[model samples]
Target: MNKRQILQLVILIIVILAGIRFYIYIDVLRSGGDAGVKTGIVEGFLPISALMSLKKFLLTGIYDYIHPAGLTLLIFFLIISIIFKKSFCSHICPVGFVSETLSHIGLKQRINKYLFHTLTILKYGLLAFFVYIILINLTVSAIESFLNAPYNIIADAKMLQFFTDPSRTTVIVLAVILLLTLISKNVWCRVLCPYGALFGLVSVFSPFKVKRSEENCTGCRKCTAACPNDIQVHTKSRIDTPECFGCFDCVNARNCDDCLKVTSGMNHKLLPYVIAVLLTLTVAGAMTAGLWKSTVTNQEYRRHLNVIDKLSH
Candidate 1:
């Protein structure tokens, strides 16, 4: 199968895994006691805690116990961004899959160029603000306090409830975003996701890129039309845009035999296979190293779930 189809399958697998994790939590809640299964991978939704843990790790060399999985997941994605150019977003992110699916419901309508630029900048601005807040305010003690807070201990439960029992404001915001995405391809990923912006910045340093052969000499602009980020692919000999997701749609769009390809010193059609192997090994290594799960125990989760139950009601 082609890369796009492979990416869709990957997304489906991830979504299923996430669903199973959420099911474990819900089962525990329904049992009113230990159901004997807990999945820390769900903590990946807690990006704020991950950022705090990352800061603590940098300053003190202490790996975060409170949300170890979140921190590790964040690190894994950053590594992918460095090596594979934001493949996490294009190939693995469940939310990105949802956005892409929604955006494909109809033909995409273009927004004003000025408005599009402003919206694109908003994500970077949000990333900058978050970085500033985390860097300026974070300390070892602060991290400890935040991690140990009752609210944080029950955060996963709350996150689940946030979707299953969303507030009116949450419903409205999500509806608006979904509507926007239906009209424009990847409105959230391209214009409003801080995580995407973070990966975009890191991907700037990646050696891998889509390089065009100038001598091939066809400027059909098919690549530009296929680009979700609206990058001008036909004009450039090399695509160095941090906005590039390395989705390979541009390369695939070109009918010319040698006009375009994703390369790093050499062309390898099995690059996706290499990336998949690397990703699988990294996750497996992290699990075997005992860094995949959080330090929180079933007893702690039981107590935390009680608190979450109380808070929700």
Candidate 2:
């Protein structure tokens, strides 16, 4: 398969993995492994843990920041953007995968494209209404409920039961997103996902962009045609537009199928992962060191008590 097809398959796998992981975690917790999470590691390198701590942020507003999922997700996204600008959304995002696949089969008709574009604006509106405004006014309980309500009650707890319930709206929404992806194209990500909105906002700052090399341009318009996100690749001077998802389909250097010769390069920055790795290491080290020190001190105190009892005897 071509790069695009390969990327699509990868995205499908990631989505499936994420769903399964969440499911398994919930089941494991229910099986009474609640206090058995092995989060601490040597020098603070958590192979499977999130970059930052969102579990605390989600479970309680106090925000101790244990195993932050959201912040780590954002950091990981930055690394991906650095390698290939917005490629995560274009190539990996489950929602994007759904939409692109659907575009090929279900939304191939002209009317489908028009309808998809028109309705996409609703996603933006929903973000503005629900996330920016409503979430702040409500309590954490309310926020959790809303987040999990569509799937199950979020109340900051594991949600396996929600998935088990076929009648639940949470399952329905996920089903709808998947169904629409096969039928429509990235309908959820493009139009409704507040998380995408958040990422898009930061992605505006992405440095590595797809640019058109004017000299090499025998603009046959294949790039424009091949672009799933519908970017005008031939004429645009700045290829790093917000909508551009860093899928390098137009470049001639990487592959021959490219419509025009494009000079795709990075900004002054290399991989966004550089910064994230450093930050993650620092935080992870600090957490490990701090916890380890405390554990050692407690053990020493216990030893001292035993010595004192032996001396008294």
Candidate 3:
């Protein structure tokens, strides 16, 4: 495997381990046993809670105690996007790794460029709706109310339950997405993930970008063909598109090294490692600051778990 794939695999394994630990912790709680530790890694899945927490933090300067890691991770991802242009999707996201793997199966097909572009709008629309609901519509009181709600307190457990015991509708939707991804490359990341849409929007201001040297170009179109995001790399001297994942597939595809390069003195091969280090440091910093773990007591978790099914958003 390449460096990028290796990094992604390592991250996926770590996340899986964390998920398993989290499941055992929750299962112990459900059985009225003392689950000594609670893993906060699952908080990464609670983006909506993180968004609400972000709003509260901005307004009052008080960080979320219930799921502080969620907000920390959300902020980390945004900062990463601003500097690295969606490197998280290419190098860290488990879902993105799964989608990439699925894309290698079956007959790889490409949707018409026009239709693909049209479908890409769906993610942006979903992001806009979320932005409106969380950032614009909700008042500070409403945000605080939701953040402290019983349902929100146990959202991580709920999310685990969602996958461990998925509803028929959820199963069907996931199956369809998987099937689509098998036929077409990165269908979910390219067209439907609101998280990716958010990152792509923020990445527009990133200083680093792919630069093509026309003088050194052979017009082989290998760079364009190698782009998983369907970005037309050969036709443009500079790729400033938000959709660019900074995967450097195009750069590696070039016949000549100088034909394709990243701007701002960044080495393409070292970029993924840089991202991995930054992610590690970010999580470490949060842990040092006592912000990586939830402040909710084990007793509180047990109390919430007892009525978890009765809680609603």
Best candidate (score: TM-score): 3
Query: How do the residues 4-40 of candidate 2 rate in per-residue lDDT, one tens digit apiece?
Result: 5555576467546655655554455444454233222
lDDT by residue (1-313, candidate 3, tens digit) is 5688789999899989999999889889888889986887899999999999999999999999999999999999888888887787878888988888777664656667778888999999999999999999999999999998889999999999899999999999999998888777789999999999988889888877999999999999999988878788999999998888878888887889889888867677888789889989999999999989988998898899899889898
Model 1 is weakest, by summed lDDT over 10 consecutive residues, at 265-274
Better model by lDDT: candidate 1 vs candidate 3:
3
Looking at model 2, how many pairs of residues clash? Answer: 10
> 1 or 3, which is superior by TM-score?
3
Error of 3 at 209 (Å): 0.4
Worst 10 residues of 3 by lDDT: 102-111
Off by over 4 Å in 2: 1-25, 28-67, 78-84, 105-107, 112-115, 134-162, 168-183, 213-219, 235-237, 252-313
Model 2: what TM-score?
0.58
Error of 2 at 239 (Å): 3.6
The Cα error of candidate 3 at residue 112, in Å, is: 1.9
After superposing candidate 3 on the true structure, give the runs of residues whose Cα lies further than 4 Å from its correct spot. none
* Clash totals for all candidate models: 0, 10, 0
Q: What tens digits encode model 1's per-residue C-alpha lDDT throughout 1-313?
A: 4664476578578756876777776676667755665676687788888888888898889888877778888998888889878777777777877777776674657666467767798899999998987878666797778888868877877887888789999999999988888777788998889989999999988877988998994888888888766778888999987778878778777869789877776444565676677767876887788777777777777777765756531
- lDDT (Cα atoms) of all candidates against the true structure: 0.78, 0.48, 0.88
Ranking by lDDT: 3, 1, 2
The predictions' CA RMSDs to the true structure, in order, are: 2.5, 11.4, 1.2
